[model samples]
Target chain A: METLTTPLLIRGRGVVSGRVEGEALVTTQTISGWGGINERDGSIIERRHELVGQSFAGKILVFPGAKGSSGWSAFFHMTRINGVAPAAMLFTRMTTKMALGAVVTRVPAMTDFDADVFTEIRTGDHVVVDADAGTVEVTRR
Target chain B: MHLTDTEKAMRDGAGGEAVAAAMDLLIRYGNALGAERLVETDNVAGAFNASTPSVRKIAENGMAEVFSRLNLDSDKTVEIPQMAARTCQLITGIDDQNWALQGADPQMVQMQRDSEAFVGQRGVNLMATCTPYQVGNVPTFGEHCAWMESSAVIYCNGALGGRTNVEGKESTGAAALTGRIPYWGYHLTENRYGNRHIRVEVPVRSMLDWGLLGYFTGEMVEENIPVLEGQMSGVDLVKLKHFGAAAASSGGVEMYHIPGHTPEARIADEAFGPNRAEDFHVYDAAARKKMYDTLQSAEDRKVDFIMLGCPHNSIEQVGRIAHLLDGKRLHPDVALWVHTPRAIRTVAERSGYVARIEAAGGKVMSDTCPAISRRLPEGVRVIATDSAKQAHYLPAIAKVQGWFGSLEACIEAGLTGTWKGDF
Candidate 1:
């Protein structure tokens, strides 16, 4: 296997580093589109979701983009209130909902990574995503 | 990122609180999607939910109060024509008959009132429906916009080729206040192309079928915007509206491409910009049927709750329902509700549509829908609705069997109290 240094480095001033070193929970499926996510509780409510019942609390979430509604950010805001928000988010394409969610959730998020990162990343992969450098480093547990 | 002088001024805090807050969000959103600057958008369409009591308390006394204290109301204006109402039951408790009299958390009531006042004072028009495009906020292809409706985001992005992110409520509110948005996602020309190509093999004969196809497509695509191709043909604003809401609810996609319907996808390769992905396999009829069957109730029980208007019903839509059930009576056991904006309800009443619906034993409700309405009237089971948007969310809200279909079918089921036929 080829060891890559940075799948892609995306830089932005908004990125903030909170508690670091967390497990990466990747989903080709982004978070709930509508009110599927309970801000009161950070549980995923999209019944058929692979990550159903999973919490974004402290996990580095890797996703494609925000789907569904603009309400996408509010649910994430609720999660922030409950203290179960993600540590960071890495998106292939950044949508407004995801961006707003990141702001409200106050988590470090880096988007517009190289395409290869989407293909290579897997759920539960132990990775370090540095928002300051806008780099996502992944290593299999 | 490039910002016009006004946008720069707003970002620089010369534009007051609402604009500044919006600027912060726009800047962050722009930076997130690699947008170099802000674009000037004169017209902005928005959809934001009313906060719950506890929720509003925080926003009002905590956040909104700060705005009032600073005397920043005059500069904020919402160019949009509408907003989507959240659950009213939150403001009106379950047992309370009249919403204003209901013991909904006082804070919730204050919040809704404050939001409504804000919308009114700012001239937001308050259409109170999910599909603002149905009312007036139609964004033409490639026009930059900020909207809160996810389904509308997908429709504008996919069907109309308009640019918008399924932006959050506050950001949309901010955009309304500032008439600007961060250029990214569907806003950017490069991102509008379809990533995964999907083909439809099933004959989507009815609106319900189309909605089901959208739900399945949303599942297959997940978060990625898909360029949908196949024998699937003929999608209108109404059909796209319903399908888009379902897709947005099921998937978080703000944009999608229907090969022929969407402006960008008039031809296949055109939608992909320059970066085209390899051909993805077609979704077969069996898969489509599987999705439809899954959405349909497995049990052949009688529906006790029949609700119309998820994404909130338009005046025309409500009038159509009233026409269908002209003289028929709803099943006594079933509670029938048709939701619309209070403004539309006034029109419906003035036009005698409300009387017809009410005479049919159905309630033409306003200011709430099942999804955001604080509570579903207690003891509602086997909920049925004509809206895929409503159907998709009601199963969770009702926590029981939910059926979706046409207005005629929903009425029939409401009359018979059974949603067993192939509606």
Candidate 2:
């Protein structure tokens, strides 16, 4: 919603298949689901986190991976149930917590990117995630 | 993603609607992880209780609805079937024995009971503490398990050599119904070797020392394996539980090695067999002091609550706390709760540890911790704990200022109602 740039294409292994477009919310730090976010509205609640108080609802959340408790999937599942889940997810690290979380959140998610997604994309960029095609198209703002 | 005939049949509804849903979830979960196939498992530790406020509305529709939606990740509610594997519960939000002290609503307490009864009838052993290993679910070396609770996952992998990735609520629920989890991550032997090496330079003898070392190791080597070398001794069930829990909380360390001490690693070479330590780090006195500093999240000197037995304390920890508080009473403004397994609390009661603790103005609670229950004594703003894991999490989870220290320091803070801690 800020600026326009030529669309940049990136590829990765799509884990959960779907297609959606939304503004990007990128964080290089891994997210902690259980203590990290408020499920009611998808706001980062972890005190020391860089994105504290920022809500990821309806945005394409781009992060490094998941950390913290095994409640990662459960909490993310709650976000979906509460109707505040991210529009799509693009993460770099692959852990059981992140995998199951992406699956249950049931959004278009891809990982193992061909390029560093953190460098290629910034928060507020328009992101089109075609998980079935294993592609992410980024338009910088 | 490769399923056998039986798995395919289960996915196709051979085992009924709930099991079919469970299998479908597993397939989706497995495929998402890029797993090669489903592996059979008889041991499953998961979160099945429906006590939390999040699941209260669903539990109203019957426990089946809660399991279908939360556990199985299926929208279609069906009659829940008995567990296919030997399953047990993990920590929950309500402490049955001390719900009143926790300020829990009585109706939610009843809901927990009803939810327990439902799962208990379905062959779910209600080992309601986080440390199921202490309560007789000690997995054997090389035993495959599907489990939740990050602390327990590390203990299972690093301490017992039992294989399991840190599974989640939905995955573990499906695993219990189907007795199968995706064969990936720690399930394969090849993935069990140590990658990061921590060469300790200090005398890591006491529980405090071990805990601080664990915190440093986990922060340095997040979810990967860490090999502990040098000055590591006096490792026991309680110490191992604390160390693993601290590591898991600070980062996501699911496994580590102590050379000859652990089950898999008879020696350092065996710990890193078929591999080499990718990086070498040191845990010296400075590192230890830094870890101690990192855990100090509180600025206020007045302490309000003191929590012990994170990962649920062992019997000895309970007894030690009892012995320390034999005659002293906590400050009237302070509330202290020492947690242990229900089974172990029974033993403590028989040994007169419970009465001693109560006389000294503390409660020996079972089945929950403040972090899991997300409950605390009313008006608690600043807390102290003997558990590094609790110190690492409670501050973020409860929005309370927290202090981290040894058991003695925590007890001193409790008795004095002030933070004059020594690290």
Question: Number of the top candidate by TM-score?
Answer: 2
Q: Write the per-residue lDDT of candidate 1 for residues B1-423, one digit (tens) a residue.
A: 688887778777775655665667667656655567666565555544354543553454443542321112212431233222111111111212235423356656566666656556555665555556655667776777666666666777777767776666556566666666676556667777777787777676566767777887777776677777776655776677777777777666667777667787777787676867555746777776666566665275788888887666777788898898898888898888887656567789999999998898887766556676545656776887777666666675446677766677778888898886452
Taking every candidate in turn, the Cα RMSD to the unseen true structure, in Å, is: 5.8, 1.0
Which pairs clash in the backbone of model 2?
none
Model 1: residues with Cα > 4 Å off, grouped in runs: A1-19, A22-28, A62-65, A90-93, A111-129, A133-141, B47-50, B59-63, B66-107, B194-202, B223-234, B256-277, B280-285, B297-300
Worst 10 residues of 1 chain B by lDDT: B86-95
Model 2: per-residue lDDT, tens digit, B7-73?
Answer: 9999999999999999999999999999999999999999999888878888889999999999999
True-vs-predicted CA distance for residue B64, candidate 1, Å: 2.4
**Best candidate (score: lDDT):** 2
Q: For model 1, give the interface RMSD.
A: 3.7
Q: List DockQ, one per candidate, in order.
A: 0.42, 0.86
